[model samples]
Target: MIDPHHAPTGTAYATAPSIVQEICLIAEASGSGPSDVSGDREFRLRKAALLDCIAVQERARYGVAASADADDAAEVAAEWLVEYDVAHSGLSRKGRDLVLAEEYRDYVRAEYEAWSRSQAV
Candidate 1:
C-alpha cells in the first residue's frame, strides 16, 4: 500500500476539481473509455460504474486496517477511489491498478469468478 497521507483539518480544495478533471482527461485521452461513448447509455454506465468503484475503494480505505498487507490477508469489501496530493479524493482514474488494489479483495475475485463462470459454458 502507498504510504497513507493525511492533510490538515479543513484543508482547502480549490485545486481538487482541476486534479479530478486531469484524471478524467487522462482516461479520455488514454482510450480506456467504453467502446461506444457516442451515446448517453454508455456514458451513464461508465459514470455510475466509476462512482460505484470509488465508493467501494473508500470503504476499503476506511475499513481496512492500517496494518493490512498482502500477507495480512482476509476477505473484505473494496472501493476504487484514486487519491492524489490534493483534495485527498477522486475517482478520476477509473480502471487503474491502484484503484483496483483499494478494492480490497472482492473486486478481482468477483471478476475472476465471473470469468470462470463464463469459461464453464
Candidate 2:
C-alpha cells in the first residue's frame, strides 16, 4: 500500500511505470490462488494505484506536449492532450474503477497517433 498521493512528486512520477508493473504482479499472484477476501481487497487497491500511475504518466506527457510549442503540430498535440485529460478524468477517477482493457489502450494509442499526424500537417 503505497500512498501515491503522499509520495514526493518527483519520485512518484519517476516510479509510475514500476507501480503499474507491481500491480500486474499482484494480479498474477492472485490469479494463481483461490479467491480470498484479503486478496481481493489487495487486488482492488493495486488496480487503483495502477490507474493513478497511468494518469500521472499521461499528465506528464501532456505537460511536455504543452511546453514544446514549436509549431502547429505541437500546438495541436497540446490541445489533444487537454481534451484527453478532460475526457479521461470524466470517465473515471484516475481510471480506478474502469477496466484497462486492450481495446481501451488501443483507442488511446490511435487517438495519439492521429494527433501526431495532425501536427505533421
Candidate 3:
C-alpha cells in the first residue's frame, strides 16, 4: 500500500493530476470505485476539479460560457482543497493545516495559470 498520505510535501503540488489519478485508482481498486461512491467532501472536490478543468478547456477555445463556470469552479476547487487538506492533515489548528495545504493549492493555481497562459497564446 503506497501511503499517499505519506507523500512528501510539495509532491502533491508538482503532481496534481497524478495525485488526482492516484486517488481515483485507489478508489477504484478499493472495490467501491470513485464513481461508485465517495464522501461528500471528496465528491465535491472532484466535481470542482472537473468543472474547473472543463472551464479552462472551454476558455482555451474562446467560449463565452467559460468565464462564469471557471470562476465558480475555481472557487469551489479552493474551498474543497482547503477542506481536503484539513481532513487529511488533521492539524490542531488552521495555521498548520494551511501550511500543509499550501503546496497543493499552489499546484492547482499553477495548473490554472498554465491553462490561462496557453489560451493567451
Query: Using Cα atoms with residue i matched to residue i, what is each candidate's TM-score against the true structure?
Result: 0.25, 0.33, 0.38
List runs of model 3 lying over 4 Å from the truth: 1-46, 63-66, 91-121
* C-alpha RMSD of each candidate structure in angstroms: 16.3, 15.8, 11.7
Residue 41, candidate 3: Cα error in Å is 7.2
In model 1, the worst 10-residue window by lDDT is 7-16
Residue 47 in candidate 1, Cα distance off native in Å = 0.2
Q: Which has the higher lDDT value, candidate number 1 or candidate number 2?
A: 2
lDDT of 2 by residue, 1-121 (tens): 2334643222323322375476668678667766663324334333433443454444455754552333233233333433444464454424533233322433333343344355558
Pairs with steric clashes in candidate 2? 73-119
Clashes of each: 6, 1, 0
Question: Which sections of candidate 2 miss by over 4 Å?
Answer: 1-17, 36-39, 63-121
Q: 1-121, model 1: which lDDT tens digit per residue?
A: 1112332111122112233563484368447565644233223323333333333344455654543442132222222212211123333344434344434333433433343355558
RMSD of 2: 15.8
TM-score of 1: 0.25
Candidate 3 per-residue C-alpha lDDT over 93-115 given as tens digits, one digit per residue, 9 for 90 to 100: 35534443334344445444454
Candidate 2 C-alpha error for residue 116, in Å:
38
